[model samples]
Target chain A: MAKNQSEVSGIFTAGSKSKPSAAKPKNPFTHPLLLGSIFPLLLVVVWEVLSRLEVFPAYQLPAPSVILGTIAGMAEDGTLWGHVFITSYRVLMGFLLGTAAAVVLGSLVGFYKHAEALFDPLIQAFRSIPSLAWVPLFILWMGIGEPSKIAMIAVGVFFPVYLNIVSGIGGVDRKLIEVGKMYGLNMFQLVRRIILPASLPSFLVGLRSGLGLGWMFVVAAELMGASQGLGYLLVVGQNTLAPETIIASIVLFAVIGKLSDWILKKLETRTLHWQDRAAKS
Target chain B: MSLQLERVGRTFAGKPAVQDVSFRAEPGEIIGLLGTSGCGKSTLLRAISGLDNAYDGVIEINGKKVNGIQKTTGFMFQEPRLLPWLNVLDNVTFGLEGNREEKQKKAGRYLESVGLAGNEILYPKQLSGGMAQRVAIARALATSPEILLLDEPFSALDAFTKMQLQDLLLEVWRSYRSTMVLVTHDVDEAAYLCDRIIVLRGQPGTVEREIAITESRPRERGSSELAAYKAEILASLDLTTETA
Candidate 1:
């Protein structure tokens, strides 16, 4: 009987006995940096092998080494740095302008029924038109200058940010709003403290997507106009029929996209640290 | 501060939820509004807290008619409802009126009082259900409001945790001496914690009965006197002693 009782007690205590240990820090080899590079490196190796075998026309599909050589030459003369700097500056400026406007307008629409009725339909209609379709009109109106390129990028960035902000604000728990009211928070305080923070994770998602679109729009804008950027390099390479230059520009675009996304992901993890803890415990 | 509600009635979609409910709670009194589900006890608490202003009649706090959300009232929902993004200390200090130092000091004291003295930096997600509710209680108390309104705050807890929280609540009440109106569905909980229990029954719930417990504080949980009060409340709700 004593043995049976011990067994029963042991069964009951099983869960408590296996206490959760603290999470061990990750090591370099197991880090996301190493893991994410594997596929890209494999693809590069395959491309270089195929190029050496002359699987495709060498002039059209230059070898990875040739692209690297072109990149080296551009770097030697400071052309690559200039292009990267100008493109990054334009994207940053346009993304900020677009996202700021969207946050303000989207918040107003989400918080008030009158604002939703007035603004939502118009925004929805405009958003359906392709972003590239605006390039010609913007170039005509603002001329083929920096203003036109920035405007195009801003237009591309706006829709996703606006939609996500509105939905995020709308999706905030009603119970939370009631808690805010119970504490005697005014309308503004309720939004600032409760609504905004609650919606921030969703807002960050919008920002990341908006940023990607900002890069795409800058390319389209630069394709049309006089500029020294990655997009201009693509146009110049095509005009000169230099496949290495085209391939080099494409590689640069991928690198910049990955770097910017990495920065945003870091910011997301920092801001939403509570979510990670919640998921773990 | 005192709370006075006269003929308080609320209607949604032309159907009355609470009709002609009247009660008055004096300063430092612990009153429990007892009922089954759909009995409008929760609705009445909401009206008293000034969250529902479309109700008929008047709710007066310290002789002043409350038209909107009252600053002197601290309300606790059934859920702890702590913002997940904030730490325990920040959650407790939320909505407080004072500057940073005063709010932090008050929040620290309240957290300590709730047996969470060393857990000020913990996030709500890291806490167990009972601990989260305690943090909610601390948040409400940190404001130092004259009246504390709680709606079924301990119903979701396990029996042991519920009992412990009940005692903690009584201890807090004894020290703070603030007017408290608790809405609950548990007979033993109401009887053990309340100085006066107001029972509600039927749809469009109105006050059916009022029983005042003159039993002294620190009374034994299983004492015959408390059991008698519980029996009476159960009977008023049409629940037999066997089921209770």
Candidate 2:
């Protein structure tokens, strides 16, 4: 009842005070990003207070300041860049390889009945197996090196990208294809002009999900035996019983993962600007 | 270009859609294929457009057999099938083959002719239904196809918008002089635009009747001549109970 009354009052105040010609600027407090930060900030404050009071063991759950100090120490030592660089390079390489392979195989299966018949069943079967299951086999074949690690992340990225690409191509509207035919577009022209653009939204969706999987598999990849990477930092922190290092490494992973996903999200928004999506309220 | 369909028949899973449908559209003539739903009016139109070639007989353009989609043919579908990703200018230039500058210039001219001069950069999602259809018309005319096939192109628009586009189509015909085969169920639309109207009927649709409109261009929409023609067309179809 209070909420409803407040909302009603809010509308009346805006209607009476705000001039239509002025185009009043929006309230910064109401911005989604600002609103989303509130809960995290509150939780961190509470956790910090409780840790300072020694309500929880410091070894298992370090205070947020301790984690930040550990990260600052790593930066001072100049070893932070090496770990970040290696992890990012491995992910980028894996993402590219996985995406390229998916596009080729997915287009083949999507476009040709024979290819779908021959390959789809096998691919689907492989997809049902746990992605981590490939770790042992990959390690055996390529050894506990960058190649095996990169290959592990690539395998994790492949399935979602491949599935989305195939479905995207298959889901292209027949009417649009007819428009291409009416224009007398040949097989190649049809695919280039019609099929490719029509399926791009789904393909971008695939890329985002595939990037998520790449991040996940990087941790598994580093577990195989790595001397560098944030995943390696997690192992080192655990072995040395430094809760601050572990917390710092996890925080770094969160920050980097969010930054990369934000970049891809921006790309998706720009590319699909023409889409008639529902307006953001 | 002249379009000829001789005993053209099509079947879907052993169920015939159109059979023994024969007609000839002379160069620069506007021919209307009129029929109720399920009479295969669209099916016959597809065969002539060469989008469907599994039909039983021959569809020829300029005395040459149409084995596949022909470059000289342009088709406007029931709904505006503009690529959503393309802006109005790019959609109009879609089928044209030329340098980018030439294509853009040609598309701009056609867009201007279609009363969409300032909407060049706007995407299809930004346009009203009438505006989108105008872009479709511009795209069709940009190719300068010798024969244009229209499948109830303005049927999805409002009544007023529909009339406006019908006039726009006629104005385009005057300028382009392209042979047109229009598939429509509207009696008034047939009387207003077509030089000759072919009526199709039955399960496996065939040519039922052919009516020639002797009235000249710019015929009054509600004039006695057009009203009489509409009555005649309705009577021929025996559609006393049917409503478009």
Q: Scoring each candidate complex against the real one, what DockQ results? A: 0.35, 0.31
lDDT by residue for model 2 (B77-161), tens: 9999999999889999999998999999999999999888866877777676777888999999999989999999989876877
- Residue A90 displacement (Å), model 1: 1.6
For model 2, residues A83-142, the per-residue Cα lDDT tens digits are: 988998899899989999999999999999999999999999999999999999999999
Error of 1 at B174 (Å): 0.7
True contacts kept of 2: 0.52
The C-alpha TM-scores of every prediction are 0.93, 0.94
Top model by lDDT, which number?
Answer: 2
DockQ of 2: 0.31
- What Cα-based lDDT does every candidate model obtain? 0.88, 0.90
TM-score, candidate number 2: 0.94
Clash count for each candidate, listed in order shown: 0, 0
- TM-score for predicted model 1 compared with the true structure: 0.93
In terms of docking quality, how is candidate 1 classified? acceptable
